[model samples]
Target: MSMTPPPGWYRDPSYPLVERWWDGTAWTDHRRQPGSVPVPLAPPEPAGHGPDRARAVALVAAGAVLVTSIVTGVFVLGRNDDGGGAAAVRTTPPATPSAPSGAAAPTGSSTAAPHSGAASVVVDELNGITLSLPKGWVAPSDVAEDDLVMTTPGTYDCPGDPGLCRHGTVASRTVTANAERSPKALAEQDIDDAANTAYDRDVLGGRPYRGITSHRLLKAGSVAVAGRAGYLVRWRVRTGAGPGGYVESLAFASSVGSESPVIVRLAFDAGAEGPPLTDMDRITEGIRPTGDTDTGGGVGSSIGPSR
Candidate 1:
């Protein structure tokens, strides 16, 4: 027989000074990794896993030194009409496994619309999509029709009672659809421009990437998506630690339709800690245009990210 750790933040078994989420049931996507704020302890548990998030540059080997100039050179420009809190999986990307030192990232059992802090399962009706989201991962009220933002649940460094995670999009996800480059090129470009470097340094830090180590494209290749062309990438970047972000990302993109060159993506901040995500690939692979994208074809149809 096995004993499960009580629901709360605990010291990540893999990394020191990190915290993980155990929502009274299973491990979650929340982490308090290497460079997060003063790690807060979870409900009566030790700091078993920390909650930290990261992002960076392009085409460089994972975790190598990258110059800010290079990031600016090939970085994807322009932001889509986004809601906020972008987050990741597939091949799937590499990550610390699930917790209680053994359990896996749990699959939610809710089929109803999310309310407050319960686990939510939301479907994009216009797109024929189904998302098995974490508790509090609900579409934002101000979300655009083409974009989606969900409330991420995790224990933050904030002093709080036990068995609770008040953190929302501080480490969140943004999924949007539009005519960007193809999945391959767009995956490469998204890293350099914002996802890894700028978003962390400029936007979050009120400055620029410290350029300690070059952001890394750990892996990139093709995936099998249902009704669309799919490409997957794994990025290793330390977007905010001023050195190397203790972050791991698994980004997936799809070029829908045979007429136009359009791309849809699952993007976000994932920490390099235990209790990693599960079933994310199935979620990404299941995406479609709600019908069909009348694209022009080819991976070079556009210049930069959609404005």
Candidate 2:
């Protein structure tokens, strides 16, 4: 520890233009510049002086302690060579927090881009899928297995609701990287599943009309989606009361980039046998990945589920 100066006035070593009070161990904020009249902290007690002089010295010492204790703040604006030359003041810098080492910054694009499907009639920006759904079709909330559900508004004869139904639903759930099936096999399997009663009961939830009477794979062929060779199969399904219903279904299978090989099934059946879908060609032809970058993929699905 350095030697403590006696508690008294001394010229400040750092600033030659001023004198400061050394409170022994530390430098006090009390300061004075040259050519200024100095205030004697303790006036000399005349030989005849007694209790009165001693009391005055005590009051002066107490005042100095009060001034130093109150000034805890730092960096009070000081007048340099200009005029506002106030006394010396103590100041300290504020502390701030910082990030720790080796932390990775946040990222935006974590999902793989689709190799094709950029030209679809509509696009689901989040899942990198494009669609050519019918007009008045709206995507609903609560999508399962990342599937896209499109619902078209219309009137239909239904068992549950008391009024005419105005909702026709279709879904396409793409399974990527299924090692158990090739593209052709995947397409065939999906088409076959579409024809089954289970797919109707579970997927349809008895919407529009129920009671599937028949389902069959109508055609299977090789096609290209996003410049990648894939297989497509058309399925014909029949549902409802007597002869029930009939609708065409399509399934596609292909590899999605470095990800696993993917197979997609897009199906529609309007409770009853719905007529041939008018927007099918545009949607299928427009299938391409929305490229590697995306802008704003917000809440809600593009097309809603069967309502």
Candidate 3:
């Protein structure tokens, strides 16, 4: 009677330079280089003298004999062809991940060139703008359609709900729907929508902040962004749950020679755990045209201090 070999790594019939995992029943996809440390296998089932155990053993023995014969034949043939030595195995490397279905493939660099002098920056090719990433901030893993968004490094359980929440977020996008509106008009008009989107209900109908209870205008004034005239509106929003935060909408004309306006939205939770409120002004000061040489003019020309 043939005896079955226990589950272990064995010479791969297909690749002479590597060993494939055998689980007693069949070959697995897992493989490793020759002479490498073997992976631990599952412990064998306890032996028994029952009729069922005998039958199982008999079946396993038969299967093992067949597998051994096949593997021996392949190994002998490989050795004979190579004059008694292992043959080289060529493997194709994994391909890079492509964009998801229906999404445009990214073109050019996603990050701004280091000429801006900022420690780090994120480039929005669609809107032809770039925003500086603060020390504790990072580029978002996923961006909305036509919008560039950045947020603080980690997520936390939202105080109002069980959903994931970030302490701070800054989003930039072109005002395509109403391109003709002035910067001041656009800033004033978009502040409420920005606040609602940030603290009220999310896109999936989940109330992360339990909805906004009240909001008061904190600052409204003209500013210069990327050397273009702009306007910003800030508001202190009180949510039905949590220690409500601040939101701001800044609108400016595109510096990419387009008549379209660009809007940067800001949101920050109010607490010691949240990002410093001063980062709002610093981020605003860091905004610039994608390829502009001068970074010091645009946001420094604010009419009043940011709160």
Per-residue alpha-carbon lDDT of candidate 3 for residues 1-307, written as tens digits (9 for 90 to 100): 3333467665544433234445554443333333434322222233345545434532122222221111100001112221221221111112211222221211111221112222376776655667777777665542221232566643444656434566777766666556456998988988877888788875445677888999988888888887788889999999888888989888887766454777788888887866787888788888787777586635655656645
Better model by TM-score: candidate 1 vs candidate 2? 2
Off by over 4 Å in 1: 1-130, 134-136, 141-146, 154-181, 197-199, 202-212, 240-279, 286-307
**TM-score: which candidate is best?**
3
Residue 293 alpha-carbon offset, candidate 3, angstroms = 3.0
Give candidate 2 regions above 4 Å deviation.
Answer: 1-122, 125-127, 141-146, 154-168, 197-199, 203-210, 240-257, 270-275, 292-307
- What stretches of model 3 exceed 4 Å from their correct place? 1-119, 142-146, 305-307
Query: In terms of TM-score, which candidate is stronger, 1 or 3?
Result: 3
Say which prediction, candidate 1 or candidate 2, comes out ahead on lDDT: 2
TM-score of 3: 0.59
Score residue 121 of candidate 2 by CA lDDT: 43
Against the unseen true structure, what C-alpha lDDT does each candidate score? Answer: 0.34, 0.36, 0.58
For candidate 1, write residues 25-126 as lDDT tens digits.
Answer: 555545432232233232222233443211110122355332221111101222333432223211111222232333454332111222454333443332
Candidate no. 2 TM-score: 0.42
Of the two candidates 2 and 3, the one with more favorable TM-score, higher being better, is 3
TM-score of each: 0.39, 0.42, 0.59
Q: Candidate 3 overall Cα lDDT vs. reference?
A: 0.58
